[model samples]
Target: MRADARKNYEHLLTVARKVFTEQGNDASLRDIARRAEVGLGTLYRHFPTREALLEALLRTSFGALAKRADELQASSDSADALITWLQEIIAFTHEHRGVIAPMVSAIEDHESALHASCVTLRSAGAALLARAQADGKARADLDGSELFDLIAALAWLREQPSHASRADRIFGVISGAILARRP
Candidate 1:
């Protein structure tokens, strides 16, 4: 890419991040282009679709979340690692607001721009869950896909104004259910 083009791309991402944070994942592309002081055509040149733009914006964070899972696996107790990673992913989805829908859909859609990142993150969570189960710390009936679905549900609550206040309490409830009984 040319220097000017690269600058525009970066600028768009910055502006899009702000806009998405304020208005959510459904924020208008035209508004992002306007905020970035770029033409809509220019935005399209860099990101042909909304999913493409989202994938670009979220790729780094997705990698970090996966890496965090790996770090937790090595450094934390099995159940603690699993719960910590779950909390992080839930917080991540809350930060991006309204991203859970696209992420959930992308997991089953190989051609989606977000598919690879979503799959990798899910696999990371799955590994943590498997480790916990192996250690007899988490419920054996739960699998990675179910864990991902639970995340989606939990994150959906966070996105709602009415439910946001209780989201953490509910997270505690869900996490408790995932753990095995000690006595």
Candidate 2:
């Protein structure tokens, strides 16, 4: 891509992320182009469909999350690392709630990109949980699948307009439950 084209693409992603957050996944792509100071043709050239745009956004976001998990694993305290990772995930979900609904629907509809994202997140969370459990900081019985379910539930809850704060509370409760000292 040309320098200007790359710049416009990045700008579109930034504008689209904010627009989707404020206006949901069905937000106007034309308006996004207008806000980004790019033409509608440019937006379509970069993101051919709504699903394509959503997948790109999620891939970008989740890729960062996976990197954070890797960094957390390299940190000193395993328990604190797990807590920090969970907190970051919760914050990401909160910020991307508008896209969550459509991404989830796409997943249910067998979208390959969304499925790959789910697999990546599941693997990252499992690695973190395994490390925490092995270090004797987390519950030995809690599997990755269970933890993923909890995160998904929290994400869905965070997506609701009325339940914005619920994700934090849920995270706290889950962290305590998983990391509490065993008798």
On TM-score, the leading prediction is 1
lDDT per residue (tens digit) for residues 1-183 in model 1: 899989999999999999999999999999999999989999999999999999999999999999999999996589999999999999999999889999999999999999999999999999999999999999999999999999999999998999999999999999999999888
lDDT of 2 by residue, 76-127 (tens): 8888988888778867877765655654555446655577776677678888
Model 2: lDDT of residue 55: 79
What candidate 2 gets wrong by more than 4 Å, as runs, is 2-8, 34-42, 102-110
Q: Please, what is the whole-model Cα lDDT of each candidate in the order they appear?
A: 0.95, 0.80
